[model samples]
Target: MEHREAAFRKLFDLYRHDIYAYGKSILKHDEYAEEIVQDVFLKIWLNREKLDPELSFRSYIFAITRNLAINFLHKAANDARLREEVFYKSQESYNPAENNIDAAYYDRIKQQAIDILSPRRRQIFELSRNRGMSYEEISKELGISVSTVKNQMSAALETIRNFLFAHSDLTLIITFIAFGWL
Candidate 1:
C-alpha cells in the first residue's frame, strides 16, 4: 500500500504540469484546467489496477486529460456564453512538444479504426460525423431507413471503441460518449 501510494505520487508529479498546460490549451480557463489536473490524477488512481506498465504512461495520461477536457468542452457547448469561448480555444493548435504527446500518432489510430469498417458502414459513419449529416439526411441521400443508419453508427462506434481498447486506453471510448454520442 505504501509503495503503491508512492508510485501514484510519482506519476502525479511527472504528469501534473503537462496535464495542466494541455487542459488550459483546450479549456481556456485556469479553474477548469486545474480541475482537469485533479480529475486526471483521480481517475488514474481509481483505475490503478488497470495500469499496464508496458504501455507508455505519458500517452495514457494525456489521453485521459484530453478526454476530460473534451468533456468540459461538450458541457460548454451547451452554454451560450461558454460555447464560443471553449470551442474557439479548442481550435488553437496543440503543441505536442509541450505535452510530450504525438498528436499524429493518435490521428493515425483514428483513421485506422475507421478504415477497419466495411465500405458501407464507413460511409455512413463519415457522413454522420464528418459531414455532420442528420440521420434523415443520410437516409434520404442513401435511400436507406434511418434505423439502418442508426444501427450502422452504433456498430461503428463499438468497433472504434474495441479498437481503442486493444490499442490504447479507455480515453477514446469516453471520447465517443463525450462527443455527445450518448
Candidate 2:
C-alpha cells in the first residue's frame, strides 16, 4: 500500500503539468485543464493498489488525459454550436460595433449553451466528457442506471445537432457533427 501511494504520488508530480498542458490544448480552458488533471490523478491514486509497477505509469496517465481532453473538446464544441444556433434563431438584438469583441461574443455564446442544458444533464455531460468517466463509473457516481447515462448523452448530442442544423450550412454542421459520431 505504501509503495503504491509513493508510486502514484511520484507519477502525479512528474506528469501533472504535461497532462494539464495536453488537456488545455484540447479544452482551451485553464480551469477545465486543472480539473481534468486533478481527476486523472485522483483516479490513479484510487487505483494505485492494482497498478503494475513494471508498466509505464506515464503512458497510463497520458492515455487517461488524452481521453479526458477529447471528451471535453466534444462537449465544448457541441455546446458552442448549440449556442450559436440559438442566438441566430432568436434574432437577438446586437450592436454591429460588437464585432470588435470577438472573444466576448464567443464566451457569451458558450455560456448561453451551457446554461441551456438541464443542471443534471450538464453536470453528467461535463463529468463524462471533461473527467473521462465511463458509463459505469458515471452511473455509480450519479446513482443512475447506465441506460440513463446513455440516454442523457444521446439527448445532449441530439439537442446540439438539431440546434446547429437549424442555423448553419450542411458542411459546417456535418464537420461539427463528426465529433459526436467519433
Candidate 3:
C-alpha cells in the first residue's frame, strides 16, 4: 500500500501539468480543461490498484483523460437533448404555449444540416465532436491522415454554418450541443 501510494504520488507529480495542458489544448476552455485534468487524476487514484506498474503510466493517464473528456461531452450532449425533450413535453403537458418554438425549430434544422453532410465527412465529424476524439487519435483509429480528418471536420462545420447563415449564437450553441458542451 505504501509503495503504491508513493508510485501514484510520483506519477502525479511528474505528469499532472502535462495532462492538464493537453486537455486545455483540446477543450479550448479553461474551466472544462481544468475539470478534465482533475477528473483524470481522480480516476487514476480511484483505480490505482488495477493499474499495471510495468506499463507506461503517462500513456495510461492520457488515454484515461481522453476517454473521460469524451464521456463528459457525451453526457453533456445527452443532457441538452433531454432538456429539450422535457422542455417541450412539459410545455405540451402543462402550458400548451409556444414561447420557445425557435429552439425546437433550430434543433431540427441542426439535425437536418448534419444529415445533409457527406457520409464520410459526417462520420468523421461525428466521431470527433460526438466522441471527442482528437484528430491524431481519430486518424490513428480510422487509419486516415490527420489532414484528411481536419479537412472533413472543417467541411462539416462549414456545411452546418452555411445551413444556419453563420449566425454566431446559433452556430455556437449548435456546435456546443452537438459536441456535448456541458
Best by TM-score: 1
Best by lDDT: 1
lDDT, candidate 2, 1-182, per-residue tens = 78867866777788988989876654445677798999898887778678887998778887788666545545545787743543343334556676567446444544455467788888777777668899899999999999999999878765654444334333233234444432
Full-model lDDT for every candidate: 0.76, 0.65, 0.68
Q: Which residue window of length 10 is worst by lDDT in model 1?
A: 168-177
Error of 3 at 38 (Å): 1.9
Candidate 2: worst 10 consecutive residues by lDDT?
165-174
Q: Which portions of model 3 miss their true places by more than 4 Å?
A: 80-182
Clashes of 1: 0
Q: Tens digits of per-residue lDDT for model 3 on 1-60?
A: 899789878877888888887765444456766888788888988987788879988889
> Per-residue alpha-carbon lDDT of model 1 for 115-144, expressed as tens digits?
999999999999998899999999999999
Kindly provide the TM-score of model 3 when superposed on the true structure, using C-alpha atoms. 0.44
The Cα RMSD in angstroms, rounded to one decimal, for candidate 3 relative to the true structure is 12.1
Estimate the TM-score for candidate 1.
0.56
TM-score for all models, in order of appearance:
0.56, 0.43, 0.44
